[model samples]
Target: MKFYCSIHEIKKTKTVLVGVPYDGTSTYRPGSRFAPQAIREASYGIESYSPYQDKDLRDIRFYDIGDIPLSYGDKELNLKLIEAFIIKLIMKGKKTLALGGEHLITYPLIKAYAKKYKEFAIVQLDAHSDLIDSYRGESLSHATVMRRCSEIVGFENLYQLGIRSMVEEDKLLPHRDVNMGLFDLSKAEEFLKRIGDKPIYLTVDLDVLDPSIFPGTGTPEPGGITYKEILSFLKLLRQKKIIGADVVELSPHYDPTGVSSVVAASIVREILLIMGN
Candidate 1:
């Protein structure tokens, strides 16, 4: 099913929603591949209107192109295929909102964005640092995705927030423009001021939220941001030049309450509202 109110025709739409349901690299949990459909299904439970932005999804003209047909075994091929699809949307001047199978999907999306925007910056919200050189002898797992993206867009251009869990080695690994460790919500203003008005590509890993509030993820970090805090941050981001965005890693079955899916859909609504403007 398509996301609620994502009824605009593809060819005539400026904003697009595409799902990449390939979770072949998830280490802790495996059901994230089903996140796209889960979020779409959960979208029906919420309204099209956003009290925070005073905007309605019904008023927006975005096309939901369904999920990217991805294969299981080949990570490189899947990434190439996803990159090609995003490139097509970019060529059409479409601002995409991708629903992911896992955080690894961000690498390919950022690859496509990097080719199009010269001054692109990545605003990543995640629980893990995702800066490892490789994981389980494979260089392209979800754990290493951000490291790969950092190489493409430069680490200085990456702004990480809401990171509360990481290995000791990850803490020592340093590069330009790298900001990790436990993030205080109060510093968001300073971080935004530092990044200024650059073309931004936002990647939100739903595990960044506390597991108590959103436990439907492969990796559940304990101390994380609240749903209201995320909304406030999105409002702050409305002033930036956001070219594209994604919400990833919501394994719906883990949370029987289905609150995680609703939160994901609501975050998508907020991001779309900001992107629409």
Candidate 2:
């Protein structure tokens, strides 16, 4: 209730970090609920100094606000709860960052934020489009996160990155608002030529990395991008109006070496450093 990683005694900081350990839809590999804990533990290994940035995100005020406890497998209730949490944080004038459960969490997040900002948009970094009508018959499945974000959330624009895998069916989806298939930064560079600029909410799914590089997620796509490539695009996005961001779908059970958690934490740190500045 007070602060995330309670022992750190971090309170009254600008960064309000919260964990949403709700991975009920991870049919392939459950355990994203544990990602927050593992990432937090690995955060101890991270340093504020970075060759990638002139300053650390902590140079500004940042603190983990704590996690939302829910494991009942109720997607509807979970969405409502997430919406309320974010709305409350905005009411408090706190900038919130939610940790992983699954990508589905982004739908409710975008919907809730759109109620506040009429000009909201999203910068999605992932291996899949996540714009399906539904995955396995659920409206809030991880595969369909962006679809719900577009249909229900009402964002003005969306720019996706690192998309290397998708069924042909996903390519023919109804919502055309999402600017899709902008994979690595190199590919995204050519893709961004047409992407222009907008106020953005960032959502990251770690499976975007090639399994050889980081094989820790609910799903792994082999032809995905690299950390360097993903970071390049995010670094460029640092100049835009990035309202908030979430790192999703990082199932820690698969990462016994904890390499993925370190990467997730690094991404948060870098984004906050570059954009949150």
Candidate 3:
């Protein structure tokens, strides 16, 4: 099913939503491949209007192009497919919003963004600093996705926020633009100033939210930013130009109440409002 408030006519909208349901590299939990449809189903439970932004989805036209077809066990081919699909959308000047199976999808999305915009910055909101050189002999895992993206778009342009977990090796990485343990508004402001007019690719891993409030992800980290706090941060980000974005890692079964999926849908609504504006 299409996301609530989405239209079927692709040519009529400036924003496009695509789902990548390939969680082949999820080392911890494997159900993220079901996230896209789950989020879509949950989207119907919320209102299209955003009281925080004073914007409504009804005012903006966007198309949800369903999930990308992926091979179950083929990581390399799937990444290539995602990259190629996104590159075509970028070339068409469509602002893309991706719904992910895992954070590893960000690597290909960033790669596609790099091909279109030479100067852009990545604003990552996650509970973990996914900067490992490699994880369990796999270089393209969700744990190492951002590391791969950093290689494509220099580390200087990558801004990571709300990171509460990381290894010793991650601590040694250069351009370590991370705010550990909490979301720092001052650091965010500084990065905004540095980004200036450059387009931003926002990647939000749902696990970034406190497990007390959101516990549907494979890796549930405690002591994360609250929902109100995250909404405030998104409101703050409204002033900047967001070229593309994604909301990843919501495994519905992990939370029997289905509240986590609704939470994800709410965040997607706000991000869509910002992108459409």
Candidate 4:
């Protein structure tokens, strides 16, 4: 089913939502490929109106194009296809919100963005840094997605928040700013001021929320921020120019209560409102 309140026509909206259901690079848990549909199903549980933003989905125009058709086992070809598809959407002047199969999808999405915009920044909200150079002999896996993206946009252009997990090697990488424990508004303000009016591409990995609240993620890290904290952070971005965004790493099977998917769907709603505003 389509996301809650999504329109049928893409030509009438500035915001376009698409799902990328490719998880070839998931190292630990592999069910994120099922997340796009899971989140869509969960969207029915919540209202289109967001009380936090004082906005309603019905007030905006957005189309859900469903998941992108991707073949299994061919990582390079899938990445190319994602990049090409995103380029088409960008060329049409649409602000894209992708429901990801894995965080690796962000690499291609940013690659497509790089082709159109000369300058932009990536705002990453996740439990892990995802800055490793390679994982298990593969350089393009989810573990290295941010590292790869840092190459395209430069390390100084990437702002990582709520990062509680990372290896020793990841610590050595030059990042513009990283909030290790939780989301800090002070540090976020610093990065926002530095970027000024640069367009932003936001990537949210659901694992950033505490496992007690959101346990349907592949790599669940403890000591995460609360749902209220996340909403507060998103509220901070309402005034910024968010060009595009994606919500990744939601493995619904891990949480049979279905709360995680609802959480993901709610975040998607808030993001849609932000884009619409």
RMSD to the native, candidate 4? 1.9
What overall lDDT goes with each candidate model?
Answer: 0.85, 0.73, 0.86, 0.88
Candidate 3 lDDT over 6-72, as tens digits, reads: 3556777878888999888888877888889889999888888899999888888787888888999
Give one digit per residue, the lDDT tens place, for model 1 in 1-277.
2353434466677788899998899999888999999988988888888999999876777878899999887888999999999999998899999999899999999989888888787888888888889899978888988889889988777778887776667666555234552653566777788788778899999988988989999989888889999899899988898899999999999999899898888888788888888
TM-score winner between 1 and 2, please give it.
Answer: 1
Query: Using alpha carbons, what is the TM-score of model 3?
Result: 0.95
Off by over 4 Å in 3: 1-8, 177-186
In terms of lDDT, the poorest run of 10 residues in model 2 is 1-10
Model 1, stretches more than 4 Å misplaced?
A: 1-8, 175-178
Q: Candidate 4: lDDT of 176?
A: 31
Range of the 10 consecutive residues with the lowest summed lDDT in candidate 4:
176-185
**Looking at candidate 1, what is the lDDT of residue 126?**
88
* Model 1 lowest lDDT segment of ten: 1-10
Candidate 4, residues 122-239, lDDT tens digits: the string is: 9989888888887889899899999999999988888888887888777667753352334433366767777789999999998889999999999998888889888988998988
Evaluate residue 19 in candidate 2 and report its C-alpha lDDT on the 0 to 100 scale.
87
After superposition on all C-alphas, the RMSD of every candidate to the true structure, in Å, is: 1.9, 3.2, 1.9, 1.9
